[model samples]
Target: MTAGPDPVAPGRTTTSSASTGELFGAVTRDLSTLIRQEIELAKAEATQSARNAGRGVGMFGGAGVAVHLALIFVSLALWWALGDPVGLGWSGVIVAVLWAIVAAVLALRGRTELRRVQGLPRTADTVKKIPHALQGHEEENS
Candidate 1:
């Protein structure tokens, strides 16, 4: 028998073989670069999301201001219409007082709602768990 062509020695390396240390260094470098890229992507997305949120808030504020202005104009028109028939000046004063009260109540309620909205936690729990989730996915894949 021809001794099965002399089985290659277990730890012997050919000229083309990469050392474990070099392989480990390459893998580490690649992983570091990948992690940095992911971090940058996350930051960019967060900034974009913040910008969108700001735009949305600005639009809401503009619409709210417009609606409030329209409400005041309509209230004034009603007051003027009522003035001639019912001692117009007193009617206007009474209407203005009532509208002011109503506006104050609405403003108070809005302030409370704004506080609630502002107090909401900004941190995303899902983002905190991403590394663990990725590890789980890798294990599953393996």
Candidate 2:
């Protein structure tokens, strides 16, 4: 008797004969690869955005320092004008008191705003569901 064609032979082309489970597995693997690629793309985009933002922030920091120096000169001029009425020492003391009050108000507001921030809750929730998705429970709720 002649031997029949072996399905298990090497270099066989799988066509319509592939089972449903095999198709499903292939789809699952493809989907996993696509997801990983998407994740890498997102990471690259985020890094570029962060670098751009860092450069912008550095420029802003330079501008802030320049403005601070200008403000210092303006404060000195104010102190000199105020000195015409009061003594020079009292004018300097008045400028110091005004700056101290402004500093206190800013510190209080910054602390309040910082306290109100909550960290990445939506991202945490999505990350938590990943294990369930891997276990094929992705459509369970739907």
Candidate 3:
């Protein structure tokens, strides 16, 4: 039978075999380089993601400013329209009252939502049980 090559030494390129120490050194160097490359890749991806997030935040800020300006113009237009029927002074007061009522309603609703928040109840429960769990005390199912 004509032997083609050594199946056990598939990674060995040299015709002369290397020592186990040399093989181990080569593997260690390759693994170290692979880990370094992976870390560098992660850093680059994180930087890119951070930059994208910054741009998105800037865009949102711009949109918010534009919306505020639009609301101001709309309020002014409504005030002028109402001024033709009522006096300009009464129209302004009417608009102010409407905005005040809107603010009050929003504030009350926001307070209610804040009150309803459970403040991570599940996380607190899990944290309290961590000491017991680590001590190998299995919790009985109720």
- Report lDDT per candidate: 0.65, 0.70, 0.67
Residue pairs with backbone overlap in model 1? 83-88
Q: Pick the candidate with the highest TM-score.
A: 2
Q: Candidate 2 at residue 61, lDDT?
A: 69
Q: Model 2 scores what on Cα lDDT? A: 0.70
- Tens digits of per-residue lDDT, candidate 3, 1-142, equal 4344457767553434566786678767865775576566556665766676667567756876888788789889999999999989999999999889977996786567446533344444544554565456737221
Top-down TM-score ranking: 2, 1, 3
Q: What is the lDDT of residue 108 in candidate 1?
A: 89
Q: Score candidate 1 by lDDT.
A: 0.65
Model 2 lDDT per residue over 8-122, tens place:
7644336556568866887788678856865665566667666766675676568768888988998899899999999899999999999899779967865675564444444
Top candidate (lDDT): 2
Candidate 3 accuracy as lDDT: 0.67
Instruction: List candidate 1 segments past 4 Å from native.
Output: 1-16, 80-142
User: Which regions of candidate 3 fall more than 4 Å away from where they truly are?
Assistant: 1-15, 79-142
In angstroms, the error of model 2 at 122 is 7.1
